[model samples]
Target: MRLVPTPEQRELRDAVRSFLAAASPMPAVRRAMESEPGHDPEVYRRLTGELGLTGLTVPEERGGTGAGHAELAVVLEETGAALLPGPFLATTLAAILLTETGEKEILAGVAAGTTTATVVLDGNRALNGAEADVVLTIDGDRVLARTDGERRPLRTLDPTRRQALVEPGGEVAAVSAAGIARARDLFAVAVAAEQLGVLRASLEAIVAYSRIRVAFNRVIGSYQAVKHRLADMHCTLEQAESIVRYAAWAADEAPAELPGAAALAQAYLGRACFEVASGSLLLHGGIGFTWEHDAHLYYKRAKADEVLLGPPRVHRARLADLLEL
Candidate 1:
């Protein structure tokens, strides 16, 4: 995959950004978050049926486009920035794990967006647990798969993405753990890419507000304090984006570097995303702090995502171990 966005990747990014801008604005996000399945099925259909993004990474033999991580990264960033309430990321995770473990049957349904799958992290919590057609987990040394059992949805800070308690079900099939660990590292990279979008959205929100929101007879951006904070946020956003891009590139073009790159991405981007979002909220003042404000949505998502793939500390530790420190 290219490090800099090729013309096609940029086009895809713009298209996704534009589509989400129209189809799932903050109001739509709020509405979708409150609805069952936590997203609009029609919107999801367009994303998969029209755009063919759900299978961006699955092989062509498995009904996918045979695209790479860069494509997935592009789509996810746009979705994350827009706070689209969908099971996209979770479904992608399931696709990735199945692809990694060579489970072609399950991968085909996932790639076609005909099946929804969720990952049970422990016995306790599930990532995108609600409204899934299948549930998968790493049971001891084997990868376990089963039709979803009764789902108990949990209220999470990020309403745009739901979590739940996925109860145990009868067995479906088992697969080898050939690339499961690598798949997880790649998943961290994927999560960090979304966080990159969240941080970028935060900075853009504050900057746009600062230019117009008047305070003391001048735009807030005129204040040196606000300028400095925005500058810091921009710098941090750049770093997060850089690491995430490298992580994605490594997963595709440089397999040997993926573990360290993925760990580094999660370690840095996770915390930076939270800081940028919280800073954006502060810059927006009273309006941003309100319940109806969109700033809180990004802020809450940043907090949740910091630990969604794995916490910053855990990734940092993994980075250290990978580097043999």
Candidate 2:
């Protein structure tokens, strides 16, 4: 029911932000994007081993820190802001699905960061599947571990996050349909949290730029046109934060509400994030269009995220169906 982060959650957020500032800076992100694996292995190792981030949401019995979605949301937001490259999101999604299906051994490896995984969604595609140690596919009520599947890397808009086409094969276990749905709802909400982070970072960047940039012998931020757009961006950022938090809270405390909350989060946030990100780029003037600027990176990430979960319209349709509208 609480939309705001708790004190512990705030502390977690600050710690994560600090860690990312040092470990996943813009230079590091750029370097990782050009690398073969598309991520820095040493950074991943420090994140899991030092921060124990991989196990934040896993139960204590399952070799995790036993935190819930709220905590996970805190970490994910920081990762999104940093444009962190690696299998972190993919691994987290797999661990969550495995938890629902009672796949303890794989869950153990995921929690320990010894294994990375990705879920094969529609189109037989998976995020980070190229480097994943496990490929999971949800079929009817069963969650399968595709041991024999082939993974082919796909070029994507955001180089920081890799995608792959997977030929799903092999079956590991059976789980309830309800469990699968719940895990997916959690996944949807998690993506929303990341989008919110992108929105936040985009807004901050533009605002900072407006103050320093000169136009017509005056600070650009003082202009009526630029000021209005900044106001709009701030409004969108605030709304997105609220929606994403509600979805995360529902995922942890209100399973019955999570499906609708997740859908609503995606329906609104997917477009909103893209708007703010694009607006930020445009507001940055000529420099934003250049490859040297970080604005383009966030812009690409926002656009890619809009379709990361099957597009905003798909979520909107699901929300309408959930409401029986």
Candidate 3:
């Protein structure tokens, strides 16, 4: 597939890149990671309010930018490149699900950057835990959940996006159960797209490092072993990109192939991202292990995101089911 983004999409991408370059540079990212919350809320507000990124997929009727998943994918790709740390993926995914199901009240705060919400698709059996004002749960074919805030500490590798254990017991809005399954599948695909960005950034960092780091009077990149490793990374990165693009396009244009495509993208990209990030770190040698280096940050995030929505094994199984294998 050509995957040619529209002019508007290109503009959005460039704008986001420029904004991050100035506001959330690598130094800022490192500073936030070491801070108490591990993120700067002010930076997030600027992203939503100034850049209008928080409302990318929101409906115009509900005070959103009214963009779609394709646009969101572009934003996420940039976020990954910048190694943005926050509740962006969680909040965006939650907002998308809520808006799609006619939950308009939630939009006002989310779009305004007042409400910070994240989907709890991590270790818990439930949809999301105490942090959410609303929980969307899938039971068989029925989608049911209530509003309540129950919080618990989670051991997380990526402090950029905090995790919570939420259990809400209150009035719940019920949607068509079938739709819940579809929404979960779509969210999985969106996550895979984001992971592709991380993978790409990691690969680029490795290549840049190899070209500069010298060993025995020659750049390490000139070594056949290093060259071969980079070759494999490129192959995996391209493959991951192919599936992510296909999944995003399928979500927006080809709904019939969505479920299968989403599963394929998630399974492949999740594993491939881990490999790429890990390789990037290894290729950087000891510096990658240090706190000052940016390589470990990407490695941590890649591992975190791989299990964010679901594990690779789970998605692989879903792909098999979708294909009737």
Candidate 4:
């Protein structure tokens, strides 16, 4: 099958890249990382209002842009490249879940960029502990809890996206278990697609750096040792891309294939992306170790995203079970 993105998808990717270059350049990312909240609300407002990015995947009837997973994937890839701060991924996933479940009010706010939500997949895997206006949980069924403000900071490798701990304080709206499963699955596919973007950009950055930096009066990239390492990184990224595309397609069309595809993408891309980012940092030598270098920023994001939904090893084991291997 042809794995290339369509012309429209390519255009979407270019548009997102262009916007990020101007609104959230490398320096902006660094500054945001150091600032409180670790994100610029102004930039987010521009992206959501002007670019209509916040509603890319919501249905058109709900004030959304009426796009699909493929289109959302393009936005994610650019976000990874620029390390754009804010809860874009979290809010996007949350919106997808709410829209899929027919949570009209939540989806409407998401489309309007008024309500920001995030998933709490770490620690307890309980949604009630997720700090949001509404917390989606699955306990024999899916439930939405409206709670009081309770947020605690989480120490993270990626400072751009913050995490927190929350507690349920009041009653919640309950929904069917099937809906919860569907929402979780969609979130998994989106997260995997985002990881693919992170892996690809990390690979490209490292390859470009290796080809230019000279050692002993010769380009390091010319050395067999450096070339081989880069070759491996490229191979891993391609494999990750394959799985990511498959997952995105499955999420959009093949319902039966989503679980396996999600597991496969998360398994391969999660570990591979981290390796690629870390390897890029190492290829930069001492400079990569410094906070001033952008390599570490990608590295931190890779590490954080790897465990966002679940770790590579967990997904790999799940894949093994799904395939009955």
Candidate 5:
């Protein structure tokens, strides 16, 4: 039997999907990408306020609904499919890791939708670095928060999501090696979930388009080659999705499996999602390459997200090492 999401998880996924379809359609995503802070404040507020999503994973004491990482994974998947911008992933990671550090005040603010934060767990930059109220980073075996710094935006492949270089500042929190590893694992799972959404969305878009796109008086989807490629993409998406679910579940119920599951998902889903996005564009013919089309956006996001949690090879190597290869 295949592992599947529970009925409640399905409901949450559908709600987020419906909300994004209306609030962050292609035009809205394009506008948000061009605007400063790279997200719609109104939509972000609605996500946290009306949906109470900001508090989805945070405990009740911290003003959150006290849900688990699985619920957050559902939201992340929808955001990925919608290409919802801003610091959603960053803020979620911060809440999870900071909670482990006993940062209750900050977690409370996060769940309340009043404060947004991000962590530069690796490298010199942070995802969603430019628009966070608080930025956490690693400095010489310690986790520090910036008292003062500036974000230098980078022109990445995906405009829907923003990336920036952040300089470190005063030490705000001290986290152990274990905490750092834990945070990184959780972050990887979130990234994997988003990529999973992209994969699924790409297949759906291509499938729908193929059915209606006529070529030489024949629907493009009726062609055998097109059918085979789409079939392969569907297989990849389904397998990668299973891995992503396992990773999310591991984060909540089985800590021993988290590292392996996260790495496997990251390694496999990165390239798989990229292929699906690229394939969707190719299968759509010339129209897919145009800027006015959303295919390019998905392609760009696929490439960017592929490298976000470390590239495919990076995770592949990690997986091997984790397996004692």
Candidate 6:
């Protein structure tokens, strides 16, 4: 498998990074977290209408660009790094389910960014469910769609993304168990890629702080304790990057291998990201623990993401099951 991103992918990454750098900086993230919709509609519009990212993994006939998971992974990495707060991730996750179940009408709206959605996996709670135009619930051997749902907001570790308890009250449809499982694996890879972004951002923040912050007449980065921790975080970042990339590639190229790849990615990345983000917070000293600092936000995001689909331990158990050991 190729370990490097192709030139086109690199360009895509750069474009997304640049757009986020300008539109969704840390201050913007803070604002978005407090906004009623929980995100910037202008930014979402630009991402979907201008950049056409929501359509990255969707098929051409489905009103998408027909790109594969590799490309989607790149965009998600940028979004994660920026700590983008919205239904973008939720919408994308919904897209995966729609694609798997062949839900053409809603999928087209999702691809065009006109319709937002979230999947209810935990019976009642769903990520970004409050603002979603479409709510999909998996009922035994079927996927149900509801335009109107009894949605009540729920408190969450990450306020950047809203969660709600939904009672879907609309149409019923059929979906295969195999399709659901495949969609789940693809979902794992997508979230892993995003966690990888949080990991990278946390490391960069601490490293930058270490250079400027002085302690005992020297930069903290010069100390062995700080340097060692930074090194460990870097190593963790590298491993998470590899696993996420391989899993994303598997989604596009090797369907049979995707299940295992997806499991490994989440198993490693979930914990690795939380550790690095927590480290970033700790290393920033008293300032990091404060609400005003951006470190806490990243830390919260890492923790939230770790449990969003399930924790690392859960994925580890899944990995063991996949290996039949």
For each candidate, the alpha-carbon lDDT, in order, equals 0.85, 0.89, 0.77, 0.76, 0.86, 0.90
> Per-residue CA lDDT of candidate 6, range 261-293, in tens?
999998998899999999999999999999999
lDDT of 5 at 294: 90
The segments of candidate 1 whose C-alpha lies over 4 angstroms from its true place after superposition are 169-178
Q: What is the lDDT of residue 274 in candidate 2?
A: 96
- Alpha-carbon runs more than 4 Å astray in model 2: none
* C-alpha lDDT of residue 57 in model 4: 88
Q: How accurate is candidate 1 locally (lDDT)?
A: 0.85
**Residue-wise C-alpha lDDT for candidate 3, range 1-325, written one tens digit per residue:** 4477889889988999898889899899888867766677789889978877778778788888887777888889889888887667767877766665666676677776666665546444332243445565444444344565556646678755566666533323466655676688778877887898899999999999998999899999999999999999999988887787788888788888888988998889888999999999999999999988989989988998888777899989988988889
User: How does each model score on TM-score?
Assistant: 0.96, 0.98, 0.92, 0.93, 0.95, 0.98
Model 1 lDDT tens row, 1-325: 5578889899999999999999889999999988876899999888877888888999998899999898889888988899878788888888888888777887888888888887776565777787778888876546777684677888888878888887665544455454777888878878888998899998999999999999889999999999999999999988888888899999889988999999999999989999999999988999999989999999999999898876799989989998889
The stretch of ten residues in a row with the least summed lDDT in candidate 6 is 167-176
Model 6, global lDDT? 0.90
- Tens-digit lDDT track for model 4 on 284-316? 899899978888888988898888777788888
Per-residue lDDT tens digits of candidate 5, residues 30-58? 99989977999999999988898877878
The digit string of per-residue lDDT tens for model 2 on 53-156 reads: 88889899999999999899889888988989999988888888988888788889888988888898777899998888889999888877875557889988
Model 6 error, position 127 (Å): 1.2
Which segments of model 3 are wrong by more than 4 Å?
123-148
Better model by TM-score, 3 or 5? 5
